[model samples]
Target: MVRKYSKNDEGVSAVIGVILMVAITVILAAVIAAFVFSMSNGVSKPYTVGITIKKTTSGAVSIVNSGGPDVGQLEHVYVTYQPVNGAAINAYNGEVPADGPDTDTLFDYIEKFDALKTVGGSFTIPAEGVGSPNKVPPTTPTHVIVTGYFKDGKQQVIGEADV
Candidate 1:
């Protein structure tokens, strides 16, 4: 025998079911997003530190330094490689003769330390260990310090470079 259905319960259960389904979907999406973000960072950042000696006949790769009064603007560009233990804030790792804390200091440090050598975004090995006068191979360096003033985001390096 069929039982009598209540009018009040008819729409309420349907709405509750729909709401529960939406909530579950949102929670799962959030959890998935968090996991993916965490994993992506590991893929991007290096686990250790090592200099990438790129074999380029055009004196390796360097940035075009200039000025634009703000970040994201391509201002002064130059070549940077390696780091000094007790080097000054504006000091160059033997890359440039006249070393001083300039606006491009952070970029210099970031480019040098960043293991993600995609296109023109990493340190270069000049003819010699010293980043000056333009040297060549045999004198090419393998290690780099890559020191920055503050954490900023340097902790990203989770590994070292094979080169």
Candidate 2:
């Protein structure tokens, strides 16, 4: 009498199914981890500060801080005057003169704002000596940029305008 052996493939199929499930779970976890890490990098919100740019009757440009919740955290401020046909002048840390030819009292104004961090902090770029040696000219539009530096080592452009 010849006896035929029955094939026992049930155990092999169960093992393969378990391996497949584990592989899928690992792949899903990796995808979710990557997404979470990528999103976490941009979790910090930018500070909000109100800034206003106004044109004066004397052909000057004024940049003012209108106050905000984050104003108290502001450590320093920088002002840049870029004329249409002249080199850019940067005012920061009392570098610009209070009153002199080819310069304005921007540094003094900014210094006060940095110290006080109050609303209505303003600086003016004059157009009186336009085309002479002044950085801002009335006839030609000038671009003004105001940057605020925070105590947390964050820097942002608080205001910008062409006047």
Candidate 3:
């Protein structure tokens, strides 16, 4: 004798299992895509940084402001330095405070005038070390790095070799 098949509760379980699997798969795929997108855009962007330092009798260091100042604006602006044997050191930093000053001045004092106004368009301090008054060599006690953040929401790394 052959057993009779019914659509009562047998094959229904299989169908339900398949449906659950498909739903779970779809949810996982969406989560993965969102994670990847976040990681990609969260770390890459354009920015500008400025560095100012007192010029040695030899090396000529200048700080300039390249391209910045947007609506999103650099929410935060700061600087850090890499020591001769340690990690980067936080040197100087300033902020525009959204509804604050137009120009965020950093390390602006070192000589007869504030270098951040005149030679700060380039956002870099030219150096070759010390002992020439024009080139900063590779043997100085003081060195610095300047980083900039733009309203676009990106971090920029700029440095002014030995100071």
Off by over 4 Å in 1: 1-12, 43-163
The models' CA-based lDDT, in order, is: 0.39, 0.67, 0.44
Q: Each prediction's Cα RMSD?
A: 11.5, 6.4, 9.5
Model 1, span 22-93: residue lDDT tens: 999999999999998888665543332222333455433322212122222222222333332333222135
For candidate 1, the C-alpha RMSD (Å) to the true structure equals 11.5
**What TM-score does candidate 1 get on C-alpha atoms?**
0.26
How far in Å is the alpha carbon of 46 misplaced in model 1? 13
C-alpha displacement of 34 in model 3, angstroms? 7.1
Which has the better lDDT: candidate 1, or candidate 2? 2
Cα lDDT of candidate 1 equals 0.39
Could you tell which candidate, 1 or 2, scores higher by TM-score? 2
After TM-score superposition, the amount by which residue 131's alpha carbon in candidate 1 deviates from its true location, in angstroms, is 18
- The regions of model 3 sitting more than 4 angstroms off are 1-16, 28-57, 68-142, 147-163
Expressed as tens digits, the lDDT of each residue in 119-159 for candidate 2 is: 87776656553232433353357776777878898878887
